[model samples]
Structures are given as structure tokens and as C-alpha cells.
Target: MKQNAIRAALAAVFLTAPVAGMAQETDLAKRVEQLAAELEKVKAELAAQRAQAAAAPRTAAPVPSTAPAQAMTNAPVSTAWATPAAALASDTVFSGYGEVNYNRPVRNASGTQTDVRRAVIGIQHRFDDKTKVVAEFEWEHGVVSASDKGESEVEQLYVEREFNGGLRGKAGLFLMPVGLLNQTHEPTAYYGVERNFVETAIIPTTWREAGLGLSGEFGDGFAWDTGLTTGFDLSKWDPASGEGRESPPGSIHQEGQLAKSRDLSLHGALNWRGYPRLLVGGSVFTGKAGHATPGFAANDARLTLLDLHTRFTPGAWDLSALWAYGRISNTEALNATFVGNPTPVPSSFAGWYLQAAYKLWQSGDYVLSPFARFESFNTARSYAAQPAGLGVPATPYERVATIGANLMVGQGVVLKADYQKFRQDKSLDRINLGLGFAY
Candidate 1:
């Protein structure tokens, strides 16, 4: 029994010893795993701290870089705020331009070849957003007459007051507001060598008188212009010579013989500008020449005019057409007295023109336009002539065709070259080359 007990006890001791060793090995493995987990947590925290340090800005860094990325994203907004204020403070609202041209006539039959076609200086001042003034002084043909004895004259001096809704008023010595090419006559504004013949002989462009005018736009792209002005007379009577002439030596005057009579005139126009590429308008005017009525033979005359003007511009092509009719009527007794046996007669006139211009080169600062124009005019439809020497009768129909080019060199300056062929009934063909400008 004692031997059996000893062997059993020894087996029990071996079994307990194996169990304690396995338990110690398992506990050590568990502790090691916990320690490894703690070490991984510390490493991750250190990496995060390093990343933050790398992103932090240095004190010496540029201001732009030091700013937070969120602030930097709003830079465009801040930049835009300052632009308008600076632009408003230094706005360029006042500007001016001028030109001086020297032209030599080619084949001018009138023996009037001359230099210095036109010298003009123009100035524009914007007093505010709505009021402006434009003034131009012109020296034409080096002092008007060929003798070079007179002084240069002021061409245009006008003040423009603009209101809301395209309403405006102009006062002072401005263009007559009669035709298309009259008010705007810069070399670049018109094609061809010069203005059409109808403008020169019949209507007489650059015809301005002292006047006050109002112009405004209505609804639906319609506009109107009306004015009150001094009138003009077709004939001048010299008191010393008793001769009836076309115009006075200095200037044309409507009040003849009767200084007490004041002349009156009216002008109105309607324009449609709905089409972006086209502008069409019609104008009319009525004028009266003040004269004293002599006995049974009335002396006063009445003049009436009607005109149509159209402009079409598409791409690089430009076209214009104009027609005008005019009439002058005198009293029956006056007509009979002037021409011994005249029963009753009324004088009338008509004129028309068509022109086209094309842009040859449009790129860059310079432009070239080649153009052609056809014009015709008649001076007499009703007339009774005095004897041959007393007063010459009005000239008959005149026709003209012109070809020319305008070269624009930079802004506000231009060079014009054109040839005009004029044909009058029972007269020689005359050619004229003219250069003119506004600014």
C-alpha cells in the first residue's frame, strides 16, 4: 500500500508541475501583446504631431503664404472691390482731336488750285454725365478768298444738354441739321473724294446759322428733330449797282432791301433706327425771305424744301441715298415787274444722289474706304429772266459722278483723295479734288 501511494503521489506532482509551466507561458504571452498595443498607440500619436509641425508657418514666410488657406480662397473678391473705385476716380471723360490738311488740286478747270484745304481744331468737354460742349474752329482755304486778305472764321460752337430718355437740346452756331453729311463731315465719315455734288450746289452743306434746336427720341425707335432759325435768300440785290446777284461778297442774307423784316425757318425730321445696320429718315424745312411789297407787285418770296435720307451699313459695306425737292414762289406782280411780260411764275428746284462705300482693310489702327457717288440737280423749274445784263437767269440742270478714297491714320486724323466730274447743260465738264475734315 505504501509503494502504491508513493508512485501515485509522484505522478500527481508531475502533472501539477506541467500545468503551472503552461499557465506561466500563457500569462507572459498575454502581457507581451498588451505592451505591443501600447507601443503602437504612442507611435501613431507621434506621427500625427510631426505632420502638424510640418504644416505650421514660419515667422519669416511671405504674408500670402502665412494666411490661412480659407482666407486665400477669398482673394478674388477683395481684389474686385478696389477696381471700380480707382476706375471712377480717374475716368477719362474729356477728350479732343484736330486735323490739318494740305491738298493740291488736280485738273481743276476753274484755275483755283490752292493749298491748305482745311485746318480745324475741335474740343469736347464733358461737364458731367449729361452736359457737354463741342466747339470747332476752321480755317478754310487759307483765309476764304484767293487774295489771302481775310481772317479765318469760327465754324461751329455749340453746347449740348442731354436729358434722360435721349432728349437733347443744342444752342449756338451749329450745323443747320439739314442733311446727312452736313453735321458729320470727318474724312472717315464720308466715302468718295468729297461730299456729293447735290450737297454742294443745291443744298450747300456746312450751312449753319445761329439757331436753337431740340432733338429727342420717342418710343419704338422713332426720333424727331425741330428747330427755329434765320432764313436764307437765293438772290442778293446790290443797292449801289442795282444788280441781282446769286450771293453777296461777304455772306448770303435773306432780308433784302427791307431791313425791318426778320426771316424765319423751321426744320423737322423723323428717323427710324430699329434695324441695327440701317438708319432711315426724312426731313423738311420751310423758309421765308423777308422783303417789302412794292405797290401792286408783291416782293416777298416763300421757299419750301423736302428731303429724304437713308443709310445702310452691313459688315464692311456702307450705302447712302438722298433726294431733295425745293421750290420758291414770288407774288404775281413782282414776277411781272422783274421780267417785263411774265404772267405768273413760281421757281422750283430738285436734287438727288446715291452713294456707296466699301471697306478694303479693316484690321489694325488704320482703315481704307473706296467709294463712288452719283448726283444731279436742277436750279430752275419756274423763272422769268430779266434782260441779259440786268440779272442772269438761274443755271440749268447739273450732274456729277465722283470716285474717291479715305485713309484713316490713327484716331481723329484722316487723309482724303477724290475726283469729281461735273457736267452742266451747255457748259464744260469740270473736275475738282477736295480734302476736308472736322477734327
Candidate 2:
């Protein structure tokens, strides 16, 4: 009986110990699971915060609106008169240009060593967008001439009106709307220090008359200009010929009924600029020549001209060329007595010239242009000279070759130098240098 009681007590103790240990393990497991759930929640919250921080900068960054960009891209621009509003109110847009020249005769008549060809100042006023006035006063030889002391010659004075649709009108003294160089002859615009002989002697560059004219361009690059001007000789009074006389000794008189000796001219030009980098154009003009004397019947004169001008620029190379020809016609009898009957009555006059230019060293603002020109003309061949008298038959033929370069110093300024070989019946080779600017 005593042995049985001891075994039973031992068994009971062992069973109780196992049950208590199991309860403790169960509570510990529950605590660990709760901790794991808290840890997962914390990790998820941290991940979300990090993602929000990374995305904030992108959402807050600046972005351009559409309307302002469209306005900037569609704005209009112009180079001629600035904005229309500014041009209208401004009393005067101050602008002027000048040239200093040194010329030496290589084979001239007097072998002159020095000549100052030009020094001038110009002023312009804008009355409104459409109308403006311009005047230029010039001094030659750096001093007043003895014959006309205290008198400064007027180079140009004109009023211009611009109309809608590419049309404009001008009156007073302005350059003859004829050749390319004749209209754009700012010294910096050309390579040679001086204009070619063909232009000077035959075309007579810088030729202007008192007149009224109209000019305009069509949509497809067509342009036309015409003017009615005083006869070249009718503008002056000759004491020997009597006031308003149409004929004088050694002068060509006007033909046709007396319309008061006023001359009429018509000119037109066609251009194609479809290629943005290259431009090609041609021009023609017809007009009557001025008479020197009154009462003597003037020989009716007609002139026809043709021109080609082009500019091309690709990479570092820039090239330009110009060519022009002129023809004049008149009746034989009127040509015979004209200008002291210099030739056996020249029936016609004709002349032409070609020029080419290339740019060297075109980087940044620095540029150098080298150029050459060849020209020839016959004055009497196109006109009839009366009574073939004296003075070597007025050969009226001239050939000239010129070579030169232009150095662009800065905005509106340039240095030019050239040497010319003139092979005419009466003139010699000449060398010229000039410095000019405009603003």
C-alpha cells in the first residue's frame, strides 16, 4: 500500500509540471505574433513616406504655359522703319553717311596727284509712317570752290510716300532709278574705292533730276517705276541761248511739239527671291536726253537698258555679280548738229560692264571682300553727231578694268582701296582709296 501511494504522487507531479510549461509557451507565442504585426505596419508606413518625398519635387517643378509661347512665336518683324507706331511719332530718325577719298591719276589729262571726291552730310524726317522728307548737303574738295564761294551744293532733297500694297511715290531730287549700283552706292556696299568708269561716264552714276515718280512691287517679285522729269538741259538758263531757248551752239535741241521740254521716263525690274539664300533680278529703263540749246530742233532720243544682279552665300563663301548694258538711239539730222557736230553724226550709243566679288575671311564681324570689274562703252555709236567737225571724231569709246578690296572695320564703316586701268581715247589709269560710313 505505501509503495503504491508514492508512485501515484510522483505521476501526478510530473503531469502538473508538463501542463504549466505548456501554458507559459502559449502566452510567449501570442506576444511574438503581436510584435510582428506592429513591425510590418511600421515598415509599410515608412515605405509610403519615402515614396511621397521622392515624388514631391517632380510635381512642384515649373512648366511653361501654352499661350505665352504661341504669342512669342507669332510676332511680326521688319527691318526698314522699325515698328509702325514708333516711326509715326518720331520727328526725325537721325541718319547720315560720309566718305573721305584720295585719288591719283595714273594717266589722267593733267596728271593730278590728289583729289577728294566726296564729303557729305544728310538728314531725314518722318512726318508720318507713309510720308518723309530727306535732304543732303555736300562739300567738295574740302573747301568751297572759287567760282561758287559760300555755296554748298545740294546732293538730294526729296519727299517720299509709302502706300499699302508695296507701292511708294517720291518727288524732288533723287537718284535715277536705273542700275543696281546707282541706287545702292553707299561706299561700304561696294568693294571698289570708286565707281566704275562705265557708270561714271556712260550711265552717269549719282545722276538725279527734279521729278516726280512712282515705284511699287507686285506679289510675285515684279516691280515697276516711272517718272516725269524736267529735261536735263531745260533746268538751266544759258545767257547765250536766251532765257528758255531750246537750242544753243554746241548743244542738242529737243524734237516734237513744245511740251515745254519736259522729259518722261519708264523703268521696270523683275526679281525672283524664292530661294532664300540666292536672289536674281533684271531691270530696264527708257528716257529722253537733255538738250543744251534752245530754238534748235532737239534730236529725239531713246534709251534701253538691261541688268543682272545676284548674291549667293554658302558656308564661308559669299559671291556677287552685276552686269548691265545701255543703248541710245536718235535720228541722223538731229544727231549731226548736236554737241558741236563732234562726230560724223553718231547714230547710236551703247555701253556695258561686268563685276564680280568674293568674300575672304568671314568670321564674326570681320569681313574682307575682293572684287574686279570690266567695262566698255561707246557714246557716239548710239547717237547721231551733227556736221562731223573737230576733236578726233568724238571717239566716245571707253574700256576700263578695276581691282580692289573692302575691309569692314565695324558697323556702318569700311576701308576701301582700288586700282583702275582706263583705256579710253582721252583718259589714263587711276588709283583711288576711300574710307566711308553710314548710320
Candidate 3:
């Protein structure tokens, strides 16, 4: 956007130079000086803008949207959280995103529902050029109350400080640099109505922890981050419930709510973006989950997860793929304690996916990108060994195929519709429609 402004200003100068020379014959020299001054000012302004643009963290979501990048400028505020990066246009910047969705099962007609999936408000306030504060509040499922099935939570709250040598540090609650979507799941940032099951079920999307961390970049296009943070508390696990079978870490995460600090977790990630329109990165997060809680059967247990992802945007094509795996250590004894439970602790879970999208058409400020994704996920790939004739049945990998299109309206609003087919659970197959915006 700043580039466009620069071009327009230069054009004005060139187009008006001759006119001023002819119209102001007596004060032509003075007029020329005025124009030169204005031109210099415009250039300086654009240069500053370009610097800030360079400082904003780049996302791994598909490119060619052009809309989301401009979403911030279209908003009421001048900036948003620029983490692992530095610079903000205003001292107090408000930026956010929201999405509402409708889903209907293909075969089970009774399972039709519309929902206000999520609404989020993010604020980034710069205390100085080197330091800033970022806080984001989120409302999920529309309403929030004791009786409502909705929730209100703090998605992120942290203070970041820039140090010499290109290093940056942040403290407080922050989102982990995990999977592709975990750091950039702003509705419009991804395709489809619901997030792909592989990410949500295997990696636990929106995962965050309270901790301190450092980030920096070097060597052409390499960036690295390492941090110590709060982790899961296995004592909270419910063997009687199927939560573990859904998302193991998510079911036991602390989310910084009086989080147990007895056993902190460590995480690290490295990314490379030297190639234009291409991004490749991988991350690892591992920690003990017992938190040393007394009488915990899995006191010696640990959790480890890792993933590799890549996104390449060439011309009108947006293509990406990811693979993630997670493990729970020493769950055998833990599962023995829940012998009769319906859902025992799983030994491991993993998933992978490949997705592609094409910019099919464009008109004015509207863009339509049709996409397809195929994924195979297993939340319960294996269980801890149990007594003979008493173990839970073996689980099958669930395969999914999703075909969808996202229509970008102007800068930030997007209309999406998709159909998803499930291989193992036909009842889960559904058609979905959604409207989302980021600004």
C-alpha cells in the first residue's frame, strides 16, 4: 500500500511540474522548491513505512490473497501485534478478526447448525520503539456465561522487547510457534470452514503457554526461537472421557489459568524464507506433563511433539503440506489404572496433509480461490498395552477430502463454502459455509 502511495505522489510531482512552471511564471522558482520539499517528505514517509512492513512477522498461510495483508490498514487502528518482529504505526493499535459458520451433515440431515464460531479483538500498544505490549481477547461460540456453552478467554498477553544483535524477547502468555496454523489461524488466514482435522486433532491449534522466550533472525533468511513455558498437567486428564482421544495436549493444557509451574516445558523452532514466496520451517515442543502432582500415576511421564511444514506460492498457485507427530511416554501404567474406562490414554497420535489452491478469477476488489485438501489423521493410533481380552479396539486412520472456495471481498471480508468427506466416519461428512473477516 505504501508503494502505491509513493507511485501516486511521484506521478503528481511529474504531472504538475510543467503546469506550475507555466502558471506561476513570476514565482516559479518558489513553487518548484515547494514541490521538491513535498516530494522529499513523501519519500521519507514511505521509507519509514517500508521499514515497519519489513519488521512485521511474515505468515505461512497461502499467498495471493492480497486482502489479509491490507486488512490492518483498513482497520480502525494503525497496527496490531508484530511479534518476533519490531515496529508499530501507532502507540495504541487495535486489530482483530471474526468468523461465523454454518454446517450440515451430508447424510444425517438432522445435524445442521449455524454458529458464531469466534470473535477476537487484539490490541498492540507501543511503549517505545524497543518495547510493546500485546493483548488479545476472544469470544468463542457467540455468547459466554455460566449457562452458555460458549467461552471468553485471553488468547494472548505479552510484552516484547527488542535487543541488540537482532534478538527479541517476550514474557507473559504467548502463542507457541508450532504448526502452520497455530501462529496464523486468523480465519481468513486459512482455507475451509472448520480448521483441518489434522492440525486441530494432532497438534492442538491455538496452543499457548505462559513463559519467556527469545527470537532472532540471521544468515540471509534463517529465524530461530527458543522458550521455556508452562505445559500440560496430566493430573487433569479424564480417562473416563474421550477428550484424550480427541486432542491429548489440548485436553490437559493449562492455558495460563493458574497454570502449574512445577514442570515447565521447552520449545524451539527454526524457519527459512530466503526464497521468494516460499517458506519452510520445523519446530519441536517437549516437556514433562506430570507437574509433580502428588499421587499422580504418570509422574514420570513426558510429552513430546514435532512437526515439519512448507508453503510455496508461485504465481497463482498456493500449495502447502505438513506432517506432525506426538507421543506420550510411559502411559502403560497410567492406562492400567483406567482399565475399565471407555477411553484409555493413547501411546501416540499423528497426521499429515497436502493442500493446493488456485486464484481462479479476479474482478475489481474481489478474488476467488478454489482449494482442495486431503488429510489422514489418527488421534488414537495406538493404546498402552492392556490385559488380554480387555483392551480397547484398534483405531483406524481417518481420511478426509475437502473441496472449497474462498471469495475475498475487498480487503478483509471473505465468504467461504466447502464440502468435506470423511473416510472412516461418514457421519462426520458435511457441507459448510462461512463468512469471516480480519482487520
Candidate with best lDDT: 3
**236-318: candidate 1 lDDT, tens digit per residue:** 43223322212121123331223223666787777776667566787777776544433434346776777788877776767
lDDT of 2 by residue, 270-362 (tens): 555445445567666666653434554443655455566665544433445556565545545444333443233334445666666666655
lDDT for each candidate structure: 0.55, 0.54, 0.80
The model with the greater lDDT, 2 or 3, is: 3
Prediction 2 TM-score vs. true = 0.64
Q: How accurate is candidate 2 locally (lDDT)?
A: 0.54
Clashes of each: 1, 27, 0
Candidates ranked by lDDT, best first? 3, 1, 2
Worst 10 residues of 3 by lDDT: 60-69
- Scored against the true structure, residue 177 in model 2 reaches a CA lDDT of 57
Would you estimate the TM-scores of all the predictions? 0.64, 0.64, 0.81
> TM-score-based ranking, best first?
3, 2, 1
